[model samples]
Target: MLRPMGREDMRAGDSDRKTVADQLKTALDEGRLDLSEYDDRLQRTYAAKTYADLDGLLTDLPGTVPVQRAQVQPHTPAAAPAPQTASPARQIAQWAGPYGAVIVVCVLIWAITSASAGHLTYFWPVWMLIPLVFGVCGQWFGKGGPHRR
Candidate 1:
């Protein structure tokens, strides 16, 4: 008769290896492991065959527990969150508020400079409209956030 598999002897899967790889990446990012050490641990992590093999790789890392076999749980459907949509006016106002302020400021500066010079300045403020144009287009055409596909 086949013996039952112990927890430590459970076969590791891609998800398991991925979890350990994430931890190793965190360790490296946090300066817990140097590049060479992290590289070695990462190699070993992917090659690990069982929970027992994966467990020891993270023993020295702080805030880590031994990898355990994942338990199966009953599947339950979660309630979907209600979709939020903004009114057309509200969407316009959102982008318009900042853009309007910037345009007003730029135009005011241009007006003052033209008044002092007795003619319209080169209208350098027109350059400021570039970003506002892009923002307006993004607001109207972008998917997601009041315009989700």
Candidate 2:
């Protein structure tokens, strides 16, 4: 009985050659292969007759798909990622850092501008602090507040 043709043994077509040529061009662009090696690989890729032949050309190049490698493998469901829930204190702390940074940066900008022109600039950054205060109040006094049993 004649054995069935395996994937590697299958004859490559023009499209297959074109795909390999594109991959080789990418390898050249990434500096993985110098101009001489790229030219050699490009020539060999066009001259390739089978998938196995094409596979050898890109075996050492990074990020190029192996021509003979199986496209699909046995599927196994991956474990789901764990959900994240932070405690009130942790949530408050997380909220504080970013807001504090914004406040500090704004205050610095205000001071610098004030000094630059010869007097204190208006403290406009106080407006930015309103959201931070409300966020903290919600975390402490809202339905999910820490004090609720």
Candidate 3:
């Protein structure tokens, strides 16, 4: 009898997400697939939680459109993370990372929790600058952010 598959062990049999993502990503980067379609497939593939689903997605990829994958040494540090700041929407998502959650939490604690506790009421107003600075830094230095990308 076959043993049940472990949750984490469940993955593309031979194909890996990174490889597949890289493949699709490379193709998209090379302009082989239509931009809109590339976005769709990529979004679908990543959204897929199972290998079976991923395989299904790729089955339709070759005929959908063709693009070349650039050879990148895995050992090399990834280039700042993103490329082509063509759309404002893409820019927004890209810059939303880099510990935004933690920063927001910290800001909340400083602005609301701490201020309420009377630990830092004097400087609570400075929290107003948090979002602005975060926005500027994220725009310029975030991994997937604008300009840096």
The most accurate candidate by lDDT is 2
Expressed as tens digits, the lDDT of each residue in 67-129 for candidate 1 is 453365799989999978776557878778988998899899999999999998799988888
Candidate 1: misplaced stretches above 4 Å?
Answer: 28-39, 69-95, 116-149
Model 2 lDDT tens row, 73-123? 789999988978667778788878888998999999999999998987788
Lowest summed lDDT across 10 adjacent residues in model 1 is found at 140-149
- Encode model 3's per-residue lDDT on 79-135: one tens digit a residue: 696654455445655556554666666677778866678776555545655785777
The global C-alpha lDDT for each of the candidates, from Candidate 1 onward, is 0.85, 0.86, 0.61
Clashes of each: 0, 0, 0
The global Cα lDDT (0 to 1) of model 2 is 0.86
Q: What's the CA error at residue 31 for candidate 3, in Å?
A: 2.9
The collision pairs in model 1 are none
Off by over 4 Å in 3: 1-15, 60-149
Worst 10 residues of 3 by lDDT: 63-72
TM-score for candidate 3, residues paired by index: 0.31
The predicted structure with the larger TM-score, 2 or 3, is: 2
User: CA lDDT of 18 in candidate 1?
Assistant: 97
